[model samples]
Target: MVHSNRCGYTYIGESGRESCCYRETWDDRERCIWHEEIAADETKPVEQLERARAPPEVRDLNGETGPREILDGTDVRGTVFPDGMDLAGVSLRDTDMAEVGLRNATLTGASLADATLVDADLRGADLRGANCWEAELNDIHLGEATLEGADLRAADCSDAILRAANLEGANLEGAFFDRADLFDATLSRTRSYGAVFSEARANEGTELDERCVYDHNSDADATRQRRESGAVRSDGGQASDTTVAGSDIDPLTKAEATYQELESLCSENALLSRQSQYFVRRQDIHTEEHWREGNWSRWLRARLSRAVVLYGESPFRVLSVTVAIIVGSALLYPLGLLRVSATGQPLMYPSPTEPIALVSTLIDSLYFSVLTFTTMTFGLYSPVGAGKLLTMLETSAGIVLMALLVFVFGRRATR
Candidate 1:
C-alpha cells in the first residue's frame, strides 16, 4: 500500500504497486472512503477557492501575456518554463531554467539574473538589453544572435558558438569564452573587463580593448587579404570559382595540368617517378653519433649563443664598421692620397702626381685601406714617401676605433 500526502489518502491492493497512484483503481471500500474525504475537504474551502481561482492578472507581477508567457515587468522569482514556452521580457530573478530552448525569441530587457542556461540553444535570439548576470551559458549556441546593450556579468560562455553574433555595447565583465567560436561577430564598443578569450577567433574590425588575447595565426589570411586589397573578397568571383573547382577537380585534370606545366619548363629534360628517382649511394654523410646527448635547454642555449655572436649585436656593430670603412675609402680615393696595386692589396700611400683613372684600382685601394685600418694587414702594399705618415695616422685611428667597438659590443652581448 502507498499513501498520498496531497489528498491524505491510502492506495491499497496490487494495483498500488504502480509508479503513480492515479494509474491504479481503488477497491470498492477504499473508493467510498476517498470520495467521502474529498467531499468533506471541499466544503470548508470557499476562501481557498477565491484565492486559487483569482484572475492571473492580479497574481502576475510583471503583467505579461498568456498561459505560456509571464507578463512584462512581472517578478517571476524562482519560476520555470516547463513546457519549453517563450518567456520573453519575463523578469526571472534567480530562476533555474537549465537546458531550455528559448531560440528565436526576443528577450529584450528581460532580467534573468543568476539563471543557469547550460547547453541551451538560444540560437538567433534577440537578447537586447537583457540582464543575464551570473548566468551559466556553457556550450550554448548563440549563433547569429543579437545581444546589444545586454549585461552578461560573470557569465560562463566557455565553448559557446557565438558565430556572426552582434554584441554591440554589451558588458561582458568576468565572462569566460575559452575556445568559443566568435567568427565574423561584431563586438564594437563591447566592454569585456577581466573576460578571458584564450582560443577565441575574432575577425577583422572586431573592436577589442587590452583584455583580448589572440593567437599568431588567428585571422591571418583575412588580415593579409584586407591589407592587400583594402577589403576581404577581391577576385571578381573568378578566384572563388577556382577555389571551389580546386576542391572538386578531377585527378586526371590535375595530372594533365601538372604535365603541361612541366613540359613547358623542362622541354629537354626527362621526367622521373618516385621509383625511378630512388637512387642509393654508399657515401658517408657525417651523421652525429650522440644526437640525443645534449638536453633541449642546453641545445637552445648553444643556438642562442651562436646567434648572438653571428647575427645579433656583434654582427650589427660589424656591419656598421664595414659601412664606415667603405664610405671612408670612397671619400679618400677621390682625394688622391690612397693608391691601388695591380694585384689586389691593402691601400698604399701613392705618388701625389699619379692619376686615379681606373674604377678597379679605386675599389682595390678602398678594400686595402679598410683591411689596413682593421689591422688585417695583408702586407701586399706599402706607402711610399709622405704617404707613409698618413697611413700610420689612419692605422692608429682604426686600432682605437676597433677597440672601442669591441668593448661596446661585448657589453651589449653580456646584457
Candidate 2:
C-alpha cells in the first residue's frame, strides 16, 4: 500500500521488494518510489510555494526618485524585469514584452531591436535614443512617452496610440501604422519612408517631410484638383479665378460644375460604348439601320467631344494656341493692324509691304483669338483705329472660350 502525503490518497498494491517508507502495507513489495514522490509533490498547494518565493522589500540605497537598473550588457536581448525599476542604458534587443506595463520607467539609450511590445503600456516612460528596429509594437499605448532620436525602423505599430509622445528624429522607415493615433505627437525630422498609413487620421500641421509618402484618400481627389488648377496656390497668393482679361469666378463653384459635367460625360460615354458594343457583339444584327442604332464608337466620340467643349479646350491645344497668339501679336504690333495709342489718340505705323502686313495681321488675329479664348492677357500689345473694334469682338469671344475651357479642363483633371 502506497500513501500520497500531499492529498491523503492511499493505494494498496504489490510492492515487488522496492524499499519505500511512504508505503503502509505490511507485505514487502517493489515499486517506483521516486515517481510516486514526484506525483505526490505536484499535488501540493501552489500558494505555499509562491509565498515562500516572495522577496522581502529591501530599503533604498539613497532614496532615489526613479527606477533601478538591474541588468547590463550590449547583447542583453530580452525582458529584464527588476519590476518598478529604472533600466537606463539597458540593451533589450529582440525581447518580448507583450501586454506588459512599464509605467513610470526610464529606459534611456536602450537598444530594443526586433522586440515584441504588443498591447504593452509604456505610459510616462522615457525611452530616448532607443534602437527599436523592426519591433512588433501593435496596439501599444506609449502616451506621453519620450522617444527622442529613437531608431524604430520597420516596426509594426498598427492601432498603436502614441498621443503626446516625442518622436523627433526617430527612424520609422517601413513601419505599419494603419489607424494609429498620433494625436498631438511631435514627429519633427522623423524618417518614415514607405510607412503604411492607410485609414490613419492626421490633422493639419502634421510634420510630413520629403521622406513620407501619403497615399490617396477620398478627399485627395478634390485636394489634387485644387492644387493642379492653381486654385489652392501655396505661394501665399490669393485664390483668384481672374481670367487673362481680369474676369473673376468662384474657384470652388467652378470646380464643382466641372466635376459634374465630367461625371455625366464619362457615364454617358461608357454606357453608350461598352453596353452597346457588348449587345451588338452578343446578338446577330443583319441590317445597317440596326448597326447605326447600336453605333457605340460614334456615340462615344460625340459624347466625349461635347464633354471636352463643356470642360475646356485640351491642354495641348490651349498651349499651342497661346504660343501662336503671343508670336503673332508681337509681329503684328509693328504693322498698322496692331497699335497701342495713348488715350484716345489714333496712331498708325504702316509697314512697307501690304501683303506681308496682311499676313502678319492674320497671324496676329489667330494669336489674339487663342489668347482671348484662353483668357491670358499678355499686356504687350493693344488695338488702335479699326483694330479696336476687332479687339473688342475678340475679347468678348475670348471670355466665352475661356469659360468653356475652364469647365472642360477642370472636369477632366479632377476626374
TM-score to native of every candidate shown: 0.37, 0.41
The candidate scoring highest on TM-score is: 2
Candidate 1 residue lDDT tens string, 43-162: 222233223222545435434442222221111222222323344555544444445555676677666655667777778888887767667788888998889878775678888889
Model 1 alpha-carbon miss at residue 203, Å: 6.9
Measured with C-alpha atoms, the lDDT of residue 15 in candidate 2 is 24
Q: What is the lDDT, from 0 to 100, of the residue 186 in candidate 1?
A: 71
lDDT of prediction 1: 0.49
Which whole-number lDDT from 0 to 100 does residue 29 have in model 1?
28
| Model 2 TM-score (2 dp) | 0.41
